[model samples]
Target: MSRKILRATYAPQPQGQLTMSEHRAAVKAVCVFPAGVYWGQSYGPRIVSGSNDGSLLIWDPETGVTNRIGQHEDLVNSVCIMPGARDRAPRIVSANRYHSVRVWCERTEGDWEWELVGQHKHFVLSVCVLPAADGEAPRIVSGTWDNKVLVWIKQLDGVWKSELVGIHEEDVRSVCVLPAAGSEAPRIVSASNDKTVRAWREQTEGVWESELVGIHEEDVHSVCVLLAAGSEAPRIISASNDKTVRAWRERGDDGWESELVGQHENLVRSVCVLPGAGGEAPRIVSGHDDHTVRVWRERGEDGWESELAGQHEHWINGVCVLPGAGGGVPRIVSGSEDKTVRVWREEAEGGWETGLARKHEDVVLSVCVLPAVGDGAPWIVSGHGDHSVRVWRERSESGWESMLVGQHEDVVSSVCVLPAADGEVPRIVSGTWDNKVLVWIKQLDRVWKSELVGIHEEDVRSVCVLPAAGSEAPRIVSASDEGMVLVWRAQSEGVWKSEVAGEHASRVSSVCVLPAVGDGAPRIISASNDETVRAWRERGDDGWESELVGQHESWVRSVCVLPGAGGEAPRIVSGSLDKTVRVWCEEQRKGWEEQICLQLDSSVSSLASYEHYILIAQGNQTVRVWLPDEDPEGQHMLWIKVPASPCDAIWNIDPQAGKLRKPEIIVGTSRGLATFTIEELPF
Candidate 1:
């Protein structure tokens, strides 16, 4: 039997590395680069990291075991440990760029459970925890440029109370909590773009006061409070755009002593302190814009010496010293803009070993499901950011077996599995960013062959298979970024021919062939970036007529042909970047009428029609199912919040999980493809 294999681009290019190939091939490099990293006090010495790909990961440095704790809505900005009771599972709070803070804890099923506990008005930059006292519940402090410094207090009744600490006028870059000393409450220190490090203290009941401790010339990007080592009082270390790490000591009553501790080649972005070997002095580590993390060591009356602790190809965003097991030598963890997180553990002779991280090599651009045969389960075929397509066959109940089906010189963007006839193996088609369309044919003798067919002038964005007609050879439709839609028909088992169906004023994003009526010529519908949906009809062989069928307020991104109820003139549903899903129904001899319009929370990235319902993949991690009704308000739409990453591609999959087989929806995100079945798809 025949199968299609594809492997090309999988994710974005690494920041410090030129290509995904270079980054993954580097043996010493561990690939996991979550935007934020922290060590949980109760967990088993595992390092918790928040990734831009919307995952919270736990890394076991000693054993090289990486566990995905949970996921975030968007790019995760900060992660802080939440103090739980001794018997309760460890809880962690993570802040994402999507303006939300979420809390996660371990579930009984060995996975994780999380809830959206709070939201900010703008991008949340930093988060820190206030250690709980004897009678008071714990509290969390977070800061951002958009709104006030929010203090979320966990009350005894289990409801979270948010208090706004309005002080910083500009962007709050970092926040650190100084534990309450004696009778004073815990102090919140924040570094900001307003050029100063300010401390907020609650003097009276529920009232807070701000005090400026030190000022920097440029934006202060990071702040950390060094644990007082007896003789030396509490000191605040700040990193900034000025390329320096300075320490501010508390002088007599609110007075401050400024000392430049170390210098970096570029602006310093993050700072952390590691315990010295055998309880000696501490080592201060700072990450810089020069793509280096420097370690500083002081020699009493002599000058301080700095060594390059870690190196990357891009600017570093976060750095933390994962407290070692049983107070051993600490390991340094650094996250970089290069899409990599490197772990450095102090080895023999003051050297560090940088090595245990792997992220998705590249983004998956499109996915399609191949149905299971009599004895097998369904297989998921995917096109990636690179020039490759992969087939993931369900091996067991939840396990998958992956096969690289095909490859292109550039990014592969789309994949479609064609229905097979009788005992014939399946055939698949793929589109790429390199303006090439390829069809893979599975022979009866069990060999898979791929041949490049239609060639466009620009990147191919979408592809679909035309349902087979009696005499029509197997045909495939492909849309390109250059506004042209090409129809390809197999000339033979080894060759294919293409013809332009029609054109859009702007780049075409999606194309679908309407259901065939008896033996009539197939009607084609396409959604364009120009905010219009156009329909094409093939008159004879070379004659193709086109007309504007529908238009949206913004760029149209997705479209699907919806069969009318009771054999009515078929209708079309279109979704666009304007955050609206519109249905266009045929109006007798007149043009298509805009029937139903439903506003969504974000841009509709993809859409699929199942039975009588339409599924929409929203740009912001949401999938909504719209059911047809006489109500114009579209109140019957059922929606589900897709977990974590942006849903870029979606499809309806037939699952063989049990005897009662039903259609389930699978969504593709930057993290991976997830299958979530809707029990109540109102058809």
Candidate 2:
């Protein structure tokens, strides 16, 4: 028998930190949303997601890309594709705020053409296409905010027509059709905000009739139907705002009986059934409002005992299986109220083991891993509430060692290492809650040289190292709680000279340097609690003048510069507490055109970008990586999970250093530090 273990990157929270006062309590709590929702194939090459942004996207499980589709006008609420249909092209349908469902055909020439389908009387919220039956034309069932279920059938002339099949007192939220069981006609199940599930069955003569399955006592938000193997009866699972999932089965004599799958602690929102694979028992996946999704499977032969398969943080909004993608293992994809979509696959071994565990004095705010240089092992540097900085090193294959501790006197808010300066050993710089900045350098031995402090008068919030400018030594810039930006340049062998100070109306939250452009003056960009980003350049005369780059509806938490593509001006990317990542490109004449690159339904805590990928870390302990060109219109690039109880600050992804030779992500948590390597992740 194989052992099942959890392998997570864990860090221990620091001990002995001054507790935050009552007034600071409200300021410390954080809320996060899902990075983005994805929809795609159930197998190998899937369609990860399409959006209201008006674009369709295709995805390859091995590599992920963003902007996979082009654009849309309103919020895209739903998508569906007809499988194994005629014309060798899948019929795709999408719903939006306009109460319209548009259909598109994939042409043999590999292009997509869109056509307006029938319009709903109100906001079309969801849509699902049913499998064709008895050589009959395929059908589409859609639920609308108008509280009605609309069924569309293809006419003998090859055109489609719609009719109202059932009505509820409140909004109809979802609809799904059950596969045929035995000789019975297929059935359709609909969930509504009125707190009930309605089953519509095809009669002997092919006419549809509705019956109420009085299972849920609150708004029934989602419903799915499952057919058990070797069993003639089909099961109906419904999720409701009442915080429970109920499974109902139709008996041979025409009566329905239900049971509770009491796992979720909040409103159950979505449910999906996983068909048996390789003779294994079938399983059920459900999403809830309490920010969790529970997977349940039958335990024994009698099917009387049910056990949890797994759980995910955040309200699970949707779940589906990739038909042929997981090497016959069957994969499950889930969406959540947290604004993220996660893909889970069972390991060949029973399960994964949890990673490392550590602690912090205050919330371990920000974490970064220094790039590994030839033969040098990577190191994780963390800043915490105790106003201190600590360094953790991965010493061996399975061991982590603490190398340095206590570098600040107040909560250390940020940490970053400067790029190496001409053979000079790189130095570590930190910003603290005490409004001071500290720089550390290696001495004759491995001991840290005397810490240089007092660079700022207010709490230091963030720190960044600007790339080299001309022949000038690289400079370290720090953002502070006092809404100031302070620049320090290396003065002597080990000391830094404060060269400039600039101000804003609110606390500076994040800072980065724009990549140089053809002799252009190096510019420093900073995002603030003021909801604006300001760009500053060192004037040839030595004074700093500031220009407003753009504005966000909420606080901008992190900013990164995507390396230039083909000599194009480097794009500046920012993540905001407003639940969006905006990309700004400079126009030769217009200052900056802010393009809403991605709208993460959640607050984005941190962001990192390489030449090929952009990574966003959220408050939910998850990271999203996106490749720019695969699909221009899709929302998700790829979703990656972090260790438990994650921080609300910037984390680092060191794609270059790791035992597996693939990019490794280093995360700082409230407890300790952990590393996520590509080899450990399902590609």
Candidate 3:
């Protein structure tokens, strides 16, 4: 007989009644940061990330290993990968609050080499690389706190040379290169805190001329070139702190005229164009402090209109739209201060939707929707504060609702709904601050029942359900603040369990069961504040042997097993307080080969995995869903923002179909019960 492997599906399960203890524990709030900034490769599958920690880390999107390239020695302000580098390894240029510019290179041996390339007399605010000139070395343009634009060019001798190009009368905030149509001598565009967009074109030989394109009364922060095929001229897009995005077109001679493209509810931070699909019209993607990424496309006859794309709970920082594979639809990737990266793709009918949210957890996150599944609408489930589990459901063509589930007595931390059970009601299990595990079930009469299992001596942190053993009832495992794994076995014919696994040293934070490993019995994996994940197997005569499989630098909060891809070896996913998620695979020589899968700018609290994506819930009350293979540039993923207070802890996330008879997101919050439905917003 062939063994069957079960893959986890996400949906909302009904919530049972809440206990007073659960309510009391749901007090602190989870907070999310800005949502727009995203990481992408201009050359390869590597991601360039700049952090408040004052370092620029280059990450391999495939392996998630990071190499610190440029050390700002202070808060690194911004980073950009240069375009059009063929022979040279990808170059990363970063600006710092310390008024310096650093360049980093990935050597042939894969190690990162860094150097302080240039120094600004004043704090450096932003940096960007231009499309290189034919046979000439690439140039990097930077904006300074002193309100100046400095251009650095690589000399023939392999040394970098710098020159003070054009000076903004006030602080320069961002610099971008707009490659001239059919020409290699690209033009430079700069935005300033002084409220202006300045355009510069390379004149005769080496001299550059500048002109004020559009004078915004408010500070301009970001700018990019929007390119389209068959067009003699490319449009320039600029975003400002004034909450508007404007487009500038060349008006005859060298002068440029500007028109207001659209307005945002909050400050605009970044903008980029989706590379055109051969004959398809070009689209523009914009990120804003409003925590949204709005995609605008030409309507063939009409100029341009906005498509919802998606919205985040925090401010948006950066966006990069990339051409898809094998003539597929184009994709847009964005990153934000909310600490995530999101990918979006266009449908056959030109409709835009979310792809996956990469679980990066960097601030300035952004999301793009992917194509909806067969007859199924895509939905987002988020766990937040307010002591409630909230779900957001998408309805009709343009409607959505938030639903609230009241169950936990205090802050609901994490939520996971078991896969649809055979001849059984779908169930949701939540870990909470009240040190108790609550199971929610819907009765045949359509009413919900919330039952408290035995209370944990400490906070119940995370939970997972094991696939039922042959003829055996399913079991639920809970991790607790006391560093222990409690396994509960079904007592009655229902999904409820009555027994405990009873093993550990400190608080067990996360638990997962591996898929059947050949004739071997299923194994349970648990991560703890003890900085280790222990794998346990049932031995003959009912005894068990538990061995430590992996170790971490700090508290391990979440654990998951990688679904088998036609392979028999076991692989597991674990997240830690050290802000990294690691994938552990067994090695013949070494006990285990641990590879970092994703790095978060902040601590990672919970994680869930789908066939092709991984969703990460953070300490900041934000969730990031990542696609590991879609973009070599690591530019594919989506970021979903949840509204939680800064200090609020996110316990769990369970994606399940609700007993309310609709797709729902059941999230545990620190305050009160909340539900987000595809039909209506939960108040």
Q: Which candidate number would show the highest TM-score if scored against the true structure?
A: 1
Decide which is better by lDDT, 2 or 3. Answer: 2
Residue ranges of candidate 2 with Cα displaced over 4 Å: 1-7, 11-362, 371-374, 420-422, 493-495, 631-634, 643-645, 648-661, 679-683
Error of 1 at 631 (Å): 39
Positional deviation of residue 187's Cα in model 3 after best superposition, in angstroms: 1.5
Better of 1 and 3 by lDDT: 1
Best by lDDT: 1
| Model 1 whole-model lDDT (C-alpha atoms) | 0.71
Cα deviation in Å at residue 458, candidate 2?
1.5
Q: Write the per-residue lDDT of candidate 1 for residues 352-421, one digit (tens) a residue.
A: 7674344333456677777677766667777765466777755435455567776777767788877777
Residue 424 in candidate 1, Cα distance off native in Å: 11
Candidate 3: residue 632 lDDT (0-100):
19
Residue-level lDDT for 582 in candidate 1: 91
Instruction: Give all candidate RMSDs, comma-separated.
Output: 10.9, 13.8, 16.0
lDDT scores of the candidates, listed in order: 0.71, 0.64, 0.61
Runs in model 3 with CA error above 4 Å?
Answer: 1-46, 55-71, 83-86, 108-110, 156-158, 182-184, 204-206, 349-353, 357-683
